[model samples]
Target chain A: MAENKIEIRNLYKAFGKKKVLNGVDLDVKKGESLVVIGGSGTGKSVLIKCIQGLLIPDSGSIKIDGVETVETSENIHEKMGMLFQGAALFDSLSVWENVAFVPLGKGKMSKKDAKTEAIRVLRQVGLAPDVADLSPAELSGGMQKRVGLARAIITKPEIIFFDEPTTGLDPIMADVINDLIIESARGLGATTLTITHDMASARKIADRIAMLYHGKIIWIGTVKEMENSDNPYLQQFITGNAQGPIQVEV
Target chain B: MLKKTLGTFLQTLGKAPLAFIINLGYFTQFVAKSVYNCFMPPFYFRLFGMQFLNIGFYSLPVVGLTTLFAGMVIAIQTYSGISEYGAESVVASVVLISVTRELAPVLSALMVAGRIGAAMAAEIGTMRVTEQIDALITLSANPFRYLIAPRIWAAIIVMPLLVLFGDIIGIFGGYLVGVYKLDFNPANYITNTMDFMKSTDIIMGMVKAGVFGFIISVMGCYHGYRSKGGAQGVGEATTNAVVTASILILIANYLITELFFAR
Candidate 1:
């Protein structure tokens, strides 16, 4: 299990005439928690989406578990789970229905047993069992995030992806979510790839941090190493300074 | 300056058709994929059942009422016009033919396009914008299989039945107006209606309803599935779905009528 869980080589994707991902190369090791930090609209999401096969790259190769994924007409989705930024729970479905979407949808579990399984997973994400029957619209933002996390981990995927997990939460709730993400991924022993601009959450959850800039990774190191590094872009981003090598278009 | 202006004009002229052709191709591909998924294995019988109830069963009141009034108005208008020619007895035959062949199928389809098409677009558009569709893909669920096929299948299956019921209600409406208001004998009206009623007219009407159902579901699902951005995008999709489906229903009506009735 010492092999790379995911590998990407020179990925490029563009929409219409606007280039979103120029040329990105990345890799994730087995059971590794790799957090990518970047400013908004820097192709962080595009990179992860390409790996998930949601968006096909213009010219690239993506391999999962030593198997090539890009340009292949195959279904490799069962091995992966994702927690979207807005939670993205189906509004028409109840909380437990959202959590157990996979097993219930595939008819792998009976309705009664599926509800029980959903409640158990919801509890693992710190949600109460009673919350299972309520609609996703009735849940608060934090609770929705928990439900999304529960859904992601319900499949016990070999690789999990988190997109802006702590974006719209209070600091306490953010910390709580970060802690739950860590516990869930650790318990599943999944290789996790998370994208965010939250430095604190990055520090708390990442084994190694990579900074994405202008569609490519600029710096990568441990937390201590990142603190001491002199890369101007990484330093500027970490400090959240306006006057720096990285410019915000405002 | 003149050369440059001509070049720019030509470029603008060329771009519109190219864009239209590209969009047409995409829409055709979407229709093809959805139709293929409708017949493939792993069919969702449960979803189809739900959509049948929603699209067919719930639409009865609106469809029934519309056809009834149309039939009544036709009976009154025909009596007024033909009574001048000393042909008052011909009103029953005219009402029966017109109701089954033109009014019942077309009017009911238009109503459904307004109700179900707009609703399907709004619901699926919301799912697309909120990323629930993407979530389904990530969860190993095919959106075409899970969402589009069931809807299109239900529409096609239930539309003919709706029109058949509408035909009966419309004929009864004409009978009510003829006997109650026009002082025509009930026995004579029934005999006239039965004499004029033909299997071809009813079958053609059912075919028209089925085709309109396909058009409505395709337009709604296509617009909604392609919607992006956010709330404004969804609004545009809903509006487009109803507008396009209505227009297509009208056009298909003419084509089908010509195919069957044109001399």
Candidate 2:
């Protein structure tokens, strides 16, 4: 397998008049956890969505395992797993079925086997096997995040994408989720890319941190490098200050 | 830059109709494939039953009330118009054929289209916005097969049944109006209704219901499948699905009526 699990080059997307994801280039290496940090609506979600072909880029090249990812085709989706910003669990499906979704239909596994495996994956994500019967609606926000993580990892995908995994939880729940994300990524030995604005969660989960601003990664380095960097945009973000080179549109 | 802008404008002008044609063709294909997928295996009898309840059974009260009042009003009006010609006895035949062959199915369709079509659009549209469709795709589930097929199948199977129910209830409403208001013998009214409605009329009406069911479900699924923007987009799709389905049902009703009854 190649070193890079995903390589996105010079991605561009625009929505009518407003430009989003202008010339974004990113690479996540195999079995590595890379976290992307950017301000809200700065195209971080759009960038990852383009990579996933949920939103196609106007012009760019996205490759997974060196296979050019204009492959929105059926063959390519089988290899991908994503944890969306909102968890995006199907309300119509039970928790265990949601986790076992891919395995049931894709692998053509019998229902009994899929259920057993769903409980196993849920347990791996620190969920009780009994939690499997509850609807996603019945779970707490943090528990939902765990279930989402369970679903994301159940398929043992070569690559996984996390969009704002820690957004809506309390600080304590956020940290728990961050730890679970790390544990899941490590357990699977999967290439993981997470986008977030939470510095604490990013610091805990990211092996290397990349800062996205104005649709470009202005700085990318180790966590230590991130703390010590002189880049103005990253500094403004890490400090959470109003007065800086970064301007929030009023 | 100016030359590029002009060239772009020209290209857009050329492409606009092409885009419309492409979308139109896609919609027709969506409808066609949905019909074909309806009868294939993994028949999801449970979901189909739930949707039958939604599309046909749950819709009974509205469809029943609407058909009752519509038949009543048609009776009242037909009596008023032809009474000058002393053709009032024909009112029974008029309301009977009208309700059975035309008004009941068409009105009930438009009503059910608003209710069930909007519900389908909103359900599927919310699913779209939340990436539930994407989730199914990732699971290697054919979303069209899972979602659209069951709904279209339920609509086809249940709509005819609903129309049959609507025809009976609506004629009863006319019977009630005719006996009480016009003093026609209730016994004569019953026989007149039986004489007026034929096997062919019932079959043709049911066939129209099936066609309308296909149109309504297809529009809802197509609009929901194409929904974008966000919740607002979903709302817009819900509204548009009803509007488009209602209009198509009327147009198709006319065409089918012409096909079955033309001189």
Candidate of highest lDDT:
1
Those runs of model 1 whose alpha carbons end farther than 4 Å from true positions after fitting are A71-74, B84-88
DockQ of 1: 0.86
Residue pairs whose backbone atoms clash in candidate 1:
none
Model 1, position A171, has a per-residue lDDT of 98
Tens digits of lDDT, candidate 1, A72-119: 566789999999999999987899999999999889899999999999
Candidate 2 TM-score, C-alpha based: 0.88
Relative to the true structure, candidate 1 reaches a TM of 0.97
Query: What's the lDDT of the predicted structure labeled candidate 1?
Result: 0.92
Q: Can you give the lDDT of residue B210 in candidate 1? A: 95
For candidate 1, state the interface root-mean-square deviation in angstroms to 1 decimal: 0.7
Candidate 1's residue-wise lDDT over B114-189, tens digit each? 9999999999999999889989999998899999999999999899999999999999999999899988889988
Could you estimate the TM-score for every candidate?
0.97, 0.88
| Candidate 2 Cα outliers beyond 4 Å, as residue runs | A71-74, B1-46, B84-89, B228-231
